[model samples]
Target chain A: MTWSEYGRLFLRHGWLMVAGAAVCGALALGLTTVQEPVFRARARISMIPGVMDWRMRDLTKELARNAVATFPSDELLAAVQDQIGLQTDAEGLRAGWDDGELIITIEAFAGDAATAGILARTAAREFHSRRSLQFTEQDFIEFIEFEIRNREPELQQIAPNVMTNVLAGLFVGFAAGLALVLMLHWRDEEWLLTRQAIEKSVPQPVLGRLRSN
Target chain B: MNTNPSSRQQDAQEQVAHELRALRASIELACHKPARSVVLLSPDNSVPTADAVWNLGLAFRTDTSSTLLADSDMEDPGLHLLADLDLAPGLRQWLEQKGQPASALAATHDHGLLVLAAGCSNEDPLQWLNTESIGWFAPALMACAERVIWRTPPLDQSPVGVLLAGSADAVLMAVRPGHTRRSRVNRAQRILAQAGIMATGTVLVES
Candidate 1:
């Protein structure tokens, strides 16, 4: 079909597209409201080498990478959970190294703000205590130190992003509605409005045309 | 005077007459031999088949040839209403009683054009569509006029149209743009083909 014909078809059925978008957007908003909100809390711990030696700095960097990797370990999570008396498993905890900062950032996700903050604080404290004990036993306590950077964990709601979900729903709904309109138009073989359409449909020749009264 | 409603009506009527004349010429050219009787059938009832039949009759009358417009669709007859004539004592009466064909024919404003309305009959009209009945009725109407136009109901709605089409010298299917469906027309054509009848051509009724 030509652009004008598509324009006419859209004009005739554009309401369906609008309705689909509205329903989907409303549904997304409704679902977001009812969904369980996840709260995230973050804590940063700086790993410093006591000596100015290059070899000590390299060892501290390696230790920081190790700390980041082991932050989400089941043993460390169990120790943190035990300290905080948290009933939930270690599934919601994540740790990463801040590039070139020699910092290990620990993040905790929970259903409530207090629980998320407590999880992050407890996890960082337990990691510091464990590393201190390991350094003392290995005779490296004089060369390395761990400092808790944030006095309080930074907390925020992370899940159920209403605006993004609603926009995505509207886009998906519009695409689905357009597909439905095209499918319906394709299925309808009865609408032979033009002379060329009629000629293509039937075997007999069209003799003459009359204007509508 | 130029912009008045009456002037517009006149212009519309002239345009319709011109279209009808062109249609009539096409029909005349398509038929190898002179078709004394032509049956016009529609696949759907929503089209203005009755008006086309009436206008085509008027177009045929312009040539000074005696033309008869017969409404054989007894089920939902409208030609009598179009001609502003009574429904009774028409084709039905003539078919049942075998009366004078002249009595059944009603003269129109045009001297050369006559209309045989679909008469009121309590009995089922399909019973009157047999070969014995049409064999008698055809010659009676043919004897009165040089050309006879039979306007039947939509073939999709009634089988009587296909039967009537089988007896006519030529058959033309009337189709209304947008209103008439492709499937209905194809089905009507298939019905005619099943009866060993092929439609001569199609008339696109814009209304």
Candidate 2:
């Protein structure tokens, strides 16, 4: 199609693009608000040498590794839920040891900050208790380290990236609107527009011209 | 610059009248003799031929007692609509049925300007045009009128237009500024030149 035809089409359907952009942008913001923000907290425990288990520490490390395999058992989660006063089924707890050498970390994520922090601490304590009973000595430190540093909240809100969401909505909406306009233009199949074009198609001297009624 | 509809319309009528007068003068000069007929063929049929023809006939009405604005376009004959003439019996019947025009010609608002409508024809107009009888029929119409202007079909749209162009003394093309394309104009001119038709020139209409 000629540029002037496209210009006419644009004038005809330009409002659609603007309306789509506005609706999509508002929808993006509304969706962000409707969905809850998630907060995550983490705690770590390490199996260290103690008085009785000091000489047999290497052998105890092996024992700790064996105990780490069942660190996040359903039973452990049930105990942590009881300690944390959780009314719901296990929804926020996750525990794992990296390569099972010596350290185990427990993480919790929830819609609220307090629950996430409580769940994390509870998981750490529950895992330590079970491992202590596995050996004769209490070598499992309660919480050797906490993930938090520099005044960071235990459960930090990590969702609803406002700027990114709005931009995505704008791009998608505009593309859809433009496609609709072009499709409409294509459907309208009138091609001839001016005197020059008609003359080129048929050899004739134009005796007169009149406005289209 | 006037945006008023009535004023704009009056200005357009005046402009068309002026152009038609100029066209009439050009045909008179090109024909160089009395009883010469000019075929008005547009590359696109949608141009305002009825109004142009009326104005053209009016331009010559004061000079001559007999001038004919013949509507030779059989397929779509609407010249009567603009000329304020009811559907009447005329030329096409004279040629096909071999009957004389048993009625008077459709007279327009202009004095000395007569309209010969395309008339009723069920046979293929193209076949009628190709017959040798077209040679005798054109001169028969010319014998009665001082100057005859035919509103023929578009040159490229139908073979009838080219045939009419062949029979007439000169071919005058009508074109609308926005509706008519330059390529179609050039192509029509080329086709007429190739077919040995005397294409007088163009009449550009603002509509």
Candidate 3:
């Protein structure tokens, strides 16, 4: 059915549809409300290009190669864990590489928000210290800015998925509601007018076309 | 008569009376065919006033002794209101007590017209109508009246009119000036035709 036709059916059976939707939505929300809450914390680490020796003839290409190969090493992670004072070892930390940036994500269920935040910040600082990078506050800020710029293209690609799901849900719900209204009327066999009676008697399929607005 | 709206109203009433007399003649002519029973439907209940049905009944006078003006429409029996009759000991009570073949006739103020009203109760009449009792009682009622004129419910929506008068020798299609549509007339025709019946003719009613 067209969107406007579906809307008219909804209005005709407005009370019934609203009652059903409200009951269903309330049950869904109630189910969600009763479940336990889980908190997720993320810490970011930016990779920097290393200085190259001029004694190598292909120094510029070598610098590019080294930057591409660079990753968060286990030795650096161990040093960070010790500094951060985390109860678990470095291997327990969750980490992933996106573009040239490394993101360490920590998910924990805490009784309170304060404890979760403390654990997140401590982990981030520990990782930074263990990387053996001599970083001034200004240098750290610059590195974070560079990594964000590098990750922009990948983030942009996933945004359309959210919009597609929203439109898809609305279309499906409208079709379901229209089908329900037609089914109810057909079951009752209310041939109110001659047109309706004629249509029923015919062997061909009678398409229910809406009048022009 | 003064030349004003009241004078125009008087002229209209005369015209309606003329038409009613003509319709009465048509019904009488129809009875010449020797059918078992003929049910004439009056477009009076659809009128604004309560006396409309009674007035219509008086207008269509046939001198035959067995000719009956029946009040069979259960939805809105305007006859009871016009005749100032009690709502008790009538059709519904008889149905409940005796359970169909309830052919005990009640003659009203009009000597020839006998009424079967909706009865005294606040309930949807379909419950009683959909029972086996009316079927059992209909043949007996048919026997009592030579030519029965039944004032039935709205033909488009209610089954009361369809069940009582749909299969009569002449189901007069009653159409109000603007309210009745061609499509609705076609529907009424089909309903009657399905039962191997057709109207004597269409009556154009103006109220």
Q: Rank the candidates by lDDT, best first.
A: 1, 2, 3
Candidate 2 on B1-207: residue-level lDDT in tens? Answer: 999999999997898668666666766565565426777777766576766666566666765367888876777776777666765576676777665433536676656577788775343567556648777777777776777888776776676777777867766676665456556666777777788886765665554
Per-residue lDDT, model 3, residue B108, is 68
* Share of native C-alpha contacts between chains A and B (below 8 angstroms) recovered by candidate 1: 0.71
Once model 1 is optimally superposed onto the true structure by TM-score, how far is the C-alpha of residue B86 displaced, in angstroms? 1.0
Q: How many backbone clashes does candidate 1 have?
A: 0
Give the lowest summed-lDDT range of ten residues in model 3 chain A: A204-213
Least accurate stretch of 10 residues (summed lDDT) in model 2 chain B?
Answer: B120-129
Q: Could you give the CAPRI-style class of model 2?
A: acceptable
Report the TM-score of chain B alone for all candidates. 0.90, 0.81, 0.70
lDDT by residue for model 1 (A1-213), tens: 889878977997788888888888888899999989999999998888899689998988887887777767777878876788877566788888875877889888999999999998888887778888888898877888778899589999988899898998898888878887786565444667767667766777888865433
DockQ value for model 2: 0.25
Name model 2 segments beyond 4 Å from true. Answer: A1-159, A173-208, A211-213, B1-67, B73-76, B97-104, B121-124, B142-159, B165-207
Off by over 4 Å in 3: A1-213, B1-17, B30-56, B60-67, B99-105, B110-112
Residue-by-residue lDDT tens digits, candidate 3, B24-60: 6665465456444444443333322224345445554
Predicted structure with the largest DockQ when compared to the true one: 1
* Interface RMSD, Å, model 3: 15.0
